[model samples]
Target: MRKTITRIMIPVVLACVFLAGCGTLAPNYTRSAPPVPVSWPEGPAYPATALPAASPVLSEMAWRDFFSDEKLKALIGLALENNRDLRVAALNIERARAQYRIQRAELFPSVGASGEGSVSRLSESLSPAGKGETIDQYGVGVGLSSYELDFFGRVRSLKGRALEEFFATEEARRSAQITLVSEVARGYLVLAADRERLALARQTLTSHQATHDLTRRRFDVGVASALEVRQAQTSVDSTRVDIARYTGLVAEDENALSFLAGTSLRAELLPDAPVNSVTLLDEIPAGVPSEVLQRRPDILAAEHRLKGANANIGAARAAFFPRIALTASAGFASDDLLDLFGSGTGTWAFAPRIDIPIFTAGSLRARLKTSKIDREISLARYEGAIQSAFREVADALAQRGTVNDQLTAQQSLVEAAADSYRLSEARFSKGIDSFLNVLDSQRSLYGAQQNLISIRLFRLNNLVTLYRVLGGGAV
Candidate 1:
């Protein structure tokens, strides 16, 4: 009996060993290199700062380290914890992980134990004894069913594709995290800028109100014409309208920030004044464009997708080959319940199946072609992601290069405008110039100041853009 059992198991064990060494039918995979330039584009628009030999890579930095304001840092933290988009991204990762596990399980057999008992009555016409008789059978066994032998690497390729997809999802989650940080910071900056604008409008209103009062008194004393008093009133009314508009804008900014943070923000944690200062690092080195491909999560995700598509092609190719499966069981069987596990009641079965693709009406060929096309699509998307990343970094660097010069020129213009307004006010007070001159100068000064604030905001926001494009704060 032992010899008979060993002879039956030998072929099964040999088949398992042969299948274990089977090669995958999938094509070899290699990363599609980025088609962008080796170095950053150079011109007056690009930063001229010396490339430090040992400066820390920006992408590895933490968000708290990148942003200096305590309030802004806290807000970023709050958004990271409570943001709905980020929460969804995390859940997506979990789902992908589970999916990968499910696919991987196909590479192994699932063993189980089952038991059965049955009784049946036979009619006398059908029985050799020519009488109705009852028969009983009992059985129990441990075995596996329809376990595919990976002789053509079909299951392995599928598992590989699933694993790559899981990695891609992880990268997507990282990309989502980085985007959330950038948006929170940008929203906070916008709120600060609105507050600054509101304050400027209030100050202008106060100055215009005082001037209106003076012009009215002067008209009462017959020292000023109705035209001058009316112009002064015009300035006051225009400023009051601006104040009301800006007040509404500030509230809207707060609401936007609240939505991004995914939680109600405390008043004390908010910026009280326009953002005059921040803790962003002085410089972010724009390394080679190819370097960003490795750092940017979106780009990494795209590449992973391409690899998964390549693995899928292998699976599709394997479909054209024969699939082998094995099902086996060993147990005991007897007619009597008490003799189910008796020493002489042993029973066993071994079944091996092979499915050869004889005809499919071109379905197998179509599937293989589909997988190849899908791989090509993924490759195109990966290259496009790299090109898009290059453009964003270049644009941010261009803005960085010119922002300081723009800020300097704006500051000089503001100074000159303020001086011109001061002289015009003095001349108007001494009756050397018309009231219209004072009004013109006041408008010029106010316009220059507003422009200056806008330039400052642009400069700061550009830094945020650079950080985002470089994949900073994504750890």
Candidate 2:
């Protein structure tokens, strides 16, 4: 009996050794495509002239430090804590973590306990006895039934995919965070620009009103004509119209800011102050272009997804091979519950199973092909993301130069218009020019001023866009 048992055990052990030597049950999948070139034509080259010398490349500066306004900081903090989108992102992270845990646990065995009882009565006619009899039986058992040994590394590969997925989800959450910060900052900037415009409109209205009153007095004294008074009235009315328009714009921007901050009540409570005026840094610190792959959350997420796709291809190919499973159980069972734990009632078992796939109606090959195709799709997407990122950064860099030039030109125009308006007003007071000339100058000046404000706002907004394109927020 001992020799017979040895013979069976030896063959089983040798089979396990042979299977182990078969290496990974999964096929090795060569990457369908080469890695995307990190250096694209649109990528920022070293020593870019557009980069400002003093502009610090956006780092993971706490939003509070970057914003600096106490109120804005408080608002951002509140949003981070309460934003619905952020909350959803956080929950997704938790879900991914749970999935990873589940996958990791599959590498371990499962244990269980069970108990059962039954009573039956049989007819005496079926037995040697001529009377009916009842028998009661009870049994209890604690055992580990089946546990797969990952000799072929299938479980390990699954765990690796799960880990990658977890990291990818984290990257997604970070991307959400970066977007949230940029959106809030941009909205706040819009509110500030609108407020500035509204203030300018009101100031213009007051000046026009004074001019109108002066013209009316002159006309009553026979020094100014009806035409002069009418022109002054027109200027005042137009300025009032501008004031109304800007007032509406301010209200709308405020509402937008409130929505972005995630609290309507807090938005209403914002301080009435212009956006903090800060000089644009002459130079911006731009790290190496390759660093973008590491710093940008979306890029990182894409890379992880690609990795997952590669792993899935391996898993798919593995399905065509044989699967091995080992199972063992040790327990106590007896007809009498009182004897369940007795030496005679002890029982145990061990089993090793191998399932070889001989045929599957072409399904296995089809699945493997599908997985390969999906990996190729993921590779393409990854390359596309890199190209898109490069283009965005390059576009932002190109815009910086153009926006700065526009701002400078607009400033000169505003100054020239102011000078022209002053001269026209003096000439009209001396009766050397018609009121129409004064009105024209005033209109030109107002338009120029408004344009300058818009340019300034655009420059600031472009700066925000540049930062975002460079993957500045949330690290």
Who wins the lDDT comparison?
1
Which candidate gets the maximum TM-score versus the true structure? 1
lDDT of each: 0.87, 0.73
Clashes within 3 Å, all models in order: 0, 7
* Candidate 2, position 280, lDDT: 29
TM-score of candidate 1 versus the correct structure, residues matched by position: 0.92
Per-residue lDDT of candidate 1, residues 267-338 (tens digit): 987778766665566677777676766899999899999999999988999898778898999898999999
Off by over 4 Å in 1: 1-22, 119-135
RMSD of 1: 3.9
Give the C-alpha miss distance for residue 291 in model 1, angstroms: 1.6
lDDT of 2 at 377: 88
